[model samples]
Target: MSRAPLLHASPDQIAAAARRVMARCDELARVTATSGRIERVYLSPEHARVNRLAAEWMRELGMRTWQDAAGNQVGRLEPAGSSRIDQRAGGHRGPALLLGSHLDTVLDAGRYDGIVGVLMALEIVRLLRMPDAASERWTSGLPFAIEIVAFSDEEGTRFGKALLGSSAVAGTWEPAWWDLTDADGTTLHRAFLEFGLDPGRIGEAARRPDEIVAYLEAHIEQGPELDRAAEPLAVVSSIASARRFQLVVEGEARHAGGTPYDMRRDALLGASEAALAVERICAAEHHIIGTVGRFEAFPGAVNVIPGEVRFSLDLRGEFDGERDRVWGSLSQELDAIMGRRGLRWRSREVHAAPAVFCAPLLQDVLRAGITQTLPSRREEPPVIFSRAGHDGMALGAIADVGMLFLRNPDGVSHHPDEAVSAGDVAHGIRALAESVLHLAAEPAR
Candidate 1:
């Protein structure tokens, strides 16, 4: 079937669409686990609420919707006269272009992190389904169908393992994850059961490698780069590689007043020096970041010396080798600091994910879309690498992946102050919709 030409929305219409998205985001923000902050984790009642809301919106646009076994909210608008089975049988050439981002968020997350992407997708569907100037449904039978997925567990706040939802769809879910537990000591297995999901049927959520044409995600630029440059949108080049560790420092506990300064083996001091080493080392390298976000010193009494210290480290970089090399340097620094303080330390890796690059074809399409949307710009849209993890990392294993970034003021994210302007969101919607049309116009592989 031949694809229909895209029907571009007017400036006023685009603004109105953006307003609807913002309103929906605000509406979803109210459906949080915490009383005063946003905290919607995987398989919680909040997840189920948002999934129902998403399904309702999808149905309003004449799309078919369902919740996958992995708890992902899914919607599909098929090519006119085509069925899901027909699209699946087409293998790698399947007539489906997947668009979406996660719905789950970290504890105390901002409203737009993943919420904006999913809502923007719904607006795109609405725009596509609109009657053209001639009052005809020209876009009803595009060559490829559109599928939007609201992933259930990208934050890993509940189970301590990120990408659980997308990993299932990507066919990369590990059986060992079933044994993972939450803060309440509920195993993932039990959570699934309590959530009305059958663990054995979880595999049903995995889509065949050949079943999707490509995966595209829209997200906020969780950094200051775009805001500093005064750009509204950018094409994402790749997601960063990352490693996380839980580290412990051991020393002898003693009375604070009795221990002489020269005889002290302060574990807290050693851990503090290690955190500084991470900052010093990572700052010297390009696109490398290391953070010690968690810290604790054993023994509650202020009059006693801290005997043990525990901390968390999160390291990320554009390249895996560079990141790992920096880790080695940081490790050596930790050893020196501990040895000098007469303390010992060890680490357990909590998470690791290699960088994932966007497909060149998708990148080109994004650039073209940006150029078309911002016709006055003589230069190409900026391309950036994401420092934060995303659902794209999991989907990259099964299908070509791409991302578009909307600017957030001051680059603040994972916090309540995280924000995006209505003007910027309007531009993002246009660019993303144009990108979909550009991809549709490409010849079938």
Candidate 2:
């Protein structure tokens, strides 16, 4: 690691940068599908609008901006004296240090979850960019180029699969995803075409390993850990390994009044037991989490017994082995409960992602950045493992990934009430900017 001195941002500069980020977030919030709530999904008109706005912002900073084949809004700032003409003519293809987060959001989402990261990246670029001799071109002093990517579809709100945008960048896009449908029955392939994208050109979005130097993202913590500690920032050690499942419990449907207690086979009751088992088993393990987010029972009539029940399970853990073990235990408990209740149960895995640890070099840089920003604190900056999924999970396949988390009040996310303090956002911007400098000081890999 390089021990070079970092150029720290002044307090006033930090505050102004943070204000710009907050205002941009509010600006993007207005371009949503829902009239009142934020709900920008993949391939939606809102997505296109945000992309245009991001591209415009990137251009304002004098960057070479474009929308990738995957619909990700990208902006690149090359080192000083780099020829823009050469870049456009395919003459420059050096590895770039990538920074950004997703632009898409879940239904009725908060403003800061992914939006802050993308905006913060822009702020960092503004802080680092300098006017060349001509005063007409913008460039950086760092050895590598800086590229900001506002990923188009990390939430998967419309297609039911997360990380679609980053997966494309990481060259991990699955062909079968094209067949996936939304609530309105529009296929992903058709949606792509309708959005003015050619499905056949999707492969052009995949970036080779050598093209990217590393990936760094600054985002809201989306948890209460930092808020509870009364801290503004933390270095993320790793993102949790996660598995999602769609489970079904089946039994015989009968008339509620005619069915005797001894003769009744209640599938809902069995499913309820299974849900409890998931909670109980995961809660017993350290750093493991289980959530039953959705549940439905067949036979909507109150007078009729439900013959089948369906539920969704979202399980995650710090370690893959521990997470899988907890899932195994939960499965056993579910089997036992169903057998005793005269019901049958089955589950289909919906999504699975392994844990992604931050690169040690990047983690050290972030720590130094935080330390520089908070010199009054005697202790080292806190380190936390993210329990939520991130685009880093997909980008990890192509380059080293690191994340700096800003405190989110009450740890609320995926809802309208999710929030972050403006002061915290200011500190986060300063720390993240310093981290970029620290990384730049290091010798080229």
Candidate 3:
């Protein structure tokens, strides 16, 4: 690791750059599936459009840009001393520092959730090489190259599988996933074909563990802790362990008017009781959260008793063991609730990702960067745990990961009202740039 001298940009410059990042996010927000809101999903035309626009920006920074086999838009900046284009060559350049987040958004998505991370990375490079001649000069002085990625799918809104793009890069793509389908019943394979991607070539997207020096992600704090602290940013300690399940409850359908209250076997009623149990159980546990975000009832007519109910459970905790314990309790609660209601219940987990801890060395660099960029009074930055899952989880499979969380005043995310302040964005950009320089200076591990 080379410990390079720290770099700083004036507050004015940072503010200007921050405005640019915001403007770009606003521009990309317009490229969505819905005319009135943001809804870019994997393999959608809007996804293609956003990639084109982001690629144009990457080109402007003089980075070699390409769409990886998995549909991620990637940009590479080689070190100034190296002329090699391929990192896998026998004459391979040193492992590049990885930067980025997913570009795809959830339904009615917020503009900054993942978009800001990619733009901030671009801005970091932009700030570092502000002098046109210095771009190459700075590149040559670095020990390793830099790579920016705008991952294609992290939301899983369209295909029901999160981290598809990052998982490919992590070499964790499952062959079984090819059979997964979207709302229109379009399989991932068919979607790849329609999007001009060859499903067979997905293996080409994988990056060896040695290919990345470290992964750094700058994302908004999807929760309200930072806002309550009145801080713009903090270093992430870990990503919460998470599990998602589709729960079903079944009972006999009957005429609502004819069914006696004492003899009722209502699936919807049982599910409603189970939902409360989830909330009640999770509420008592520290740092544990459970949400029933989606719900549906069969035989929905007002005159008919619901025969079946399906609901989604998203449970998360700071630790996997704790999370699993909560799941066990919730399962028992559901079983008891079903028994009392004389209904049948079942659950199928759709997703499970363990907690990922940020690399300590990288965390130190991030902390230093924050101090150097923000000129904080404190030597150590507040380290917050992310309850929300990120592309970092997938990337963690291949490389050490670090993260910086920018404050979202209301801590609201995954909704249309999601927002961030320009000042906080400026702080985030400067901190990210500083972290890169800190990394550039470290000796090879």
TM-score for all models, in order of appearance: 0.95, 0.97, 0.96
Candidate 2, 344-405: lDDT as tens digits: 98999999999999999999999988988888888989999999999999999999999999
lDDT of 1 by residue, 116-217 (tens): 999999888877766542222226456787889999999899999999999999999999999999999999999999999999988889998677889999
* Candidate 2 residue spans exceeding 4 A from truth: 1-5, 83-92, 130-140
Better of 1 and 2 by TM-score: 2
Per-residue lDDT tens digits for candidate 3, residues 1-445, read 3324366567788899899999999999989888888999999999899999989998788877889899999888777667646644112356888999988999888899999999999998888776673354353266787889999999998999999999999999999999999989999999999999999999888999888999999999999999998888899999999999999999989999988988789999999999999999999999999999999999799899999999999999999999999999999998899998899999999999999999998898888878876663454678999999999999999899999999997899999889999998998998888888888777778
Candidate 2: C-alpha lDDT: 0.88
Q: Cα lDDT for residue 51, model 2?
A: 94
RMSD of each: 3.0, 1.8, 2.1
lDDT of 2 at 276: 84
User: For each candidate, what is the lDDT?
Assistant: 0.88, 0.88, 0.89
Q: For model 1, give the RMSD to the true fold.
A: 3.0
